[model samples]
Target: MRAGRGLLAALALVLAAPGGLAAADPAAEARAAAESLRAAGNLLSGAEEAKDRVAALTETVRAYEAGLASLRAGLRRATIRERAIARGLEARRQELGQLLGVMLGMERTPEALLLLHPSGPVGTARAGMMLGTVTPALQAEAEILRAELEEIATLRALQEAAAGALADGLAGVQTARTALSQAVAERRELPRRFAASPDALKSLLENSDTLDSFAAGLARDSGQGPAEPGYALPPLPLPVNGTLLRGYGETDAAGISRPGVVLATRPLALVTAPAPATILYRGPLLDYGNVIVLEPAPGILMVFAGLAEVYGATGEVVPAGSPVGLMGGAAPDAAAFLKAATEGGGSSQPETLYIEVREGDTPVDPAGLFELDKD
Candidate 1:
């Protein structure tokens, strides 16, 4: 019966041993969440070129919210794991203290002294049995102590990892918050398109059936006034330096066809005017996020979208290489996204900007206009 109890106790210890069982990795999950957010950012970059700025903004906000949610979930998991480990550690500490106390008592009252101090044969026999029982119990406890020590070490390492994950999650949330704030501020700064009255422009925008109609309306309004002198198309520069994610007419992962080129740039990349141009419009349009439309010549127009902050305004003329806006950074859950992308045989996704060129109402290839070798 005693042996059966001992076997059961050993089985229980094996089952309860720290780091002995398979468990979810909170750090890995957090990294995965980050990677997903990066993918969303890539899609948002393409969405910026969509004719509807409102839809693009909505998508962008959704991505940010999703990223935040993922980070929060990871953080919660880490917190729970940390607490569980801490509780186990505390119980182990108490067990260790008791074991140490028993060891000390045995050391002070040596077996040799016990044998020497026996009162009679009857007492000696009882003492002998006590010594036999105490010896095996001490050895068993010593083995348990060793296992507990290892378990404690494992728990400490896990706690440290959980703490690191929590810190990373908090940092990612802050970055997302800052990016969102900048986007909102830029949207608020855009001037009303129609000069006559804000209500008239709002009404026109509401009544417009399509994006092309809206574009045509703006062009007609600009043409109604005195004609601006046509300027030559100078050697244009790329707005921001980065990898070309997708070219004009290419379909993105979301299956949406892009009308312009998408550049995957570093976080907070500076977006500049490609050529000397007057800003025709600078604001959020229906699906494009924070758009900046520039008229470089009488018939040619350049559009930049997916900006977190815009520097120029409507009717403001800027020279080539002049700062127009800044690209947004990755959402807070970026770490996971980068890791997953790298592991999946792809590079990390970064802030994306969309560039589009047009001649009148027809879209033109942006590739031919920019001097790619110059920069």
Candidate 2:
């Protein structure tokens, strides 16, 4: 009974700190994310205004994405830890068996017989002392064995729980996504910077053959007043929660390279503006799929492409951290997520965001402009 109770404590200690038992622990992050998820869920279900609902659900979806990532990392460590403990036990099987046998013999032997050593009182005293010393050592190993088993049970339970939390989390995220879409459609509070010229936009779309030409057209037509030369940008985080998969100028299989960074993210991951920017355009463009063109400063264009959905309107000035869109691809259900999590790096993000930073029609590396360690 004591061992059973202590097992939880042992598990907690192991998972209490990030990078504690493993080189890359995520348990602590996962716990914090779980709390955030609950709060966001409550806000999503609350009777907030449509505009507020959009904001809440946007953040809620992001929280779930981050939480799911953390859960994946945590579960991997637990699986590895369980297997390591089991292997260690197996390696010591013979020694442990001998210890158990000695312990059982000691328990059953009468106290009088143990004291009446054939050698004499002094010899008997020495033998008794040796038994006393060895007994504790054997008991200690048994306790360790019991504790390890308990930890294994806890790890198994954590995996089982992964299914429930991940399922509910994914489902809740979908609900939030639906709610966000409706709320965005109903949103009318955002003030427009300028009215987009439908004719110019249509002509540009019809004539442009590549992303470069499209961006150049948008830059010339974007109604942003002027670039403030002193508009200093603070260090920025990525527009979405994702892993940086390709750097600027990374040549692909065809030996062709684009002057942009690429990020890989889970399906339906929420993307936000890295800084306050005026939306120059938002829609499908030149095979890039759903795209957003933003004028962050004079002569500076921040283009985010390959989205599943785009929010806001052309010429709308969206604030920093405002949800802009969601990444493409079908989100995995809870069971699928758990299965992939346990498989050790099996879950590869299928959705990719192509990010381009343009300065006066020329594309350049934006990696230095944002925090790279965030991944």
Against the true structure, whose TM-score is highest? 2
C-alpha lDDT values of all predictions = 0.58, 0.73
Total clashing residue pairs per candidate? 15, 0
How do the residues 1-375 of candidate 2 rate in per-residue lDDT, one tens digit apiece? Answer: 233234334333333312212222344444555565666567666625544666676777777676677777777667778678777766766765555455445546676885678889999999878766765554565456566676676666556656766677778788888777777778788777765689989999999999899888777777544445656456788998888888899886778788898888888888899988888889998778999988777778899999999999987888888889988888887667777777755545778999998876778788867755435
Residue lDDT tens for model 1, 38-82: 656665566547654433544454454455456445544544554
* Residue pairs in collision within model 2: none
TM-scores of all candidate predictions against the true structure: 0.42, 0.85
Indicate the worst ten consecutive residues by lDDT in candidate 1. 337-346
Cα deviation of 69, candidate 1, in Å: 30
Model 2 TM-score relative to the real fold: 0.85
**Which residue segments of model 2 deviate by more than 4 Å?**
1-33, 47-51, 115-118, 223-231
lDDT of 1 at 367: 83
**Distance from true location, Cα of 243 in model 2, Å:** 1.5
For each candidate in turn, give its C-alpha RMSD to the true structure in angstroms.
Answer: 14.9, 5.6
